[model samples]
Target: MKSQLLVPAVYDFLENMEFEGFDQFYEYAIKRDVPVVSKAVGNIISFFVSLFRPTNILELGCGIGTAAKYMLTKSKANYTGVDNNLERIEVAKRFLKDFNKLKFIHSRVETFLCGTDEKYDFVFVDSIKKDYEKIWYLLKPVLTKRSMVIFDDFFLYGYIFQEEAEIPYKYREGVRLIKRFINNIKNDPTAEIVFLPIENGIMVVHYEG
Candidate 1:
């Protein structure tokens, strides 16, 4: 979900930054209308991975492994990706076959989170916006203050800030839910949230609990 909110020059500068082979996956996602993370967003996530150098990485709603590729490019951290779509999981596994430290789980995020006791030091979530609250709740059990979690498309292509009437019918409810989720996070004493206006609003979260 690319953002149209940036000025022309600023947008051009960011888009011009090279992610080398990432353009291929970006083009593939565009052609199929899949909801993969934008290269700019993916780059930001990669930046964090390089900085944190986490031992374990978890990705929810990993579509075709685009962002996973970016994050894993400079790091040797063991990665786990969860997606409910079996077909996409297969595709991701094939696409990222070179990465021996990674595994893709074809399971609903709720089920996977509930079943796993392993905590991840870093997480990237690009799933359904409306289900973010539930996902966040499930994630708390698996996150630490040192963990960095990034959620994609929180702005919903700029719809999250629009009036109820301004938003398209299909996205209005999801946008509302995201706003509520943000507010709840803001009120929580044990959680920290930071938003980056990079390509449809990326929310970075950490749990201090």
Candidate 2:
């Protein structure tokens, strides 16, 4: 994907904003080539967490617990993160060990979602685009009333709007799936969504149905 900014001026403004203790984990993630939430994305999560004050938060594809940490900083909520990456899960466990209500489960999103009977007040997803529809459908039974779901990388690094021929072979499938996911959510009469042109794109969904 190209390096075109989704919101160039807004990114420039947020780039200057300081994240006090996040630099440590940020640097570690950079060194390990692990994808973590951007400062702006984290800030947005913080905003919602503070605003909603959800009692139970679920995070899909939590990488190294950066986003979880950010959310915890903003609000005191019980958090559960699920991912298949063992190494990343380990990092998350170690990083967030001090947080009493935090838990990290090393399992696929579908596995955890299907097996658990727990309900969540909020969910943040940063997982495979192709599995998003399946995940959302499965998540329905577990979501409380007026729950909000935040999806990251919805713009697919600016490739979602491009032609299939223009996109690389590997990214084509993901782009298509994200488009389909967005379209499905948009057409769903029970859903309310707002698209934010952030670092990549943050799609916030409120399931009213």
Candidate 3:
């Protein structure tokens, strides 16, 4: 299978934005061959976390600490990021070394969920969508009563529940799964679900008090 290629033009356009600390981080990531969060997505996440300001944050599929770095700079939350990719984890570790409170786990979300005993105030899900329900089930036992969960990449170009558009297949399937996941979460008596039209799309579910 062929690996995904970086879109230099897209990156360049996003790099032109005037977000504080973003340029430095972007430069660092490029120089070190790390993954950088898309500027659009980064802005959306920064905005969401800035509003919520959760004390503890958990991130699934954190690629090279782009979002983690942004969260540390933009919000006060202590963050723990997880990704199954060891090389990405290594890059993330070095990229985020300056932040004492930020931690990266070199494990799959499934494996991490199985062994972790800690609860989080905020959980950001951006990993494989096929594992959405499984990840939710695993996290349910470790989430605070009033914790918030954000599901990213739930929609691409504003179409929901379509799995075969011009976008990536995984992304298409992810959108479909997220819709189902949101519906289920909304119907759950213990949670309130809200969708944010930012960063492809973010489904924010808050466990009821």
C-alpha lDDT (0 to 100) for residue 81 of candidate 1: 95
Question: Candidate 2 residues 8-56, lDDT tens each?
Answer: 6767778568987787678888799888888888999999999989999
Off by over 4 Å in 2: 1-3, 7-9
lDDT of 2 at 153: 78
Using TM-score as the yardstick, the better of models 1 and 3 is: 1
Q: After superposition, how far is residue 63 of candidate 2 from its true place, in Å?
A: 1.4
Q: What C-alpha lDDT do the candidate models reach, one value each?
A: 0.86, 0.86, 0.73
The Cα error of candidate 1 at residue 154, in Å, is 0.8
lDDT of 1 by residue, 96-155 (tens): 888878888989899999999888989999888899988999998898666888998878
Clashes per candidate (backbone, < 3 Å) = 0, 0, 0
Off by over 4 Å in 3: 1-16, 24-36, 156-176
TM-scores of the candidates are 0.93, 0.93, 0.77
| lDDT per residue (tens digit) for residues 1-209 in model 3 | 11122255654565467776556667776787665566766776777788878898999999777788767777767789999888877877886777777778889898998899887988878787657867888888888888888776555445563436555765666556666776777678877887765445567788764
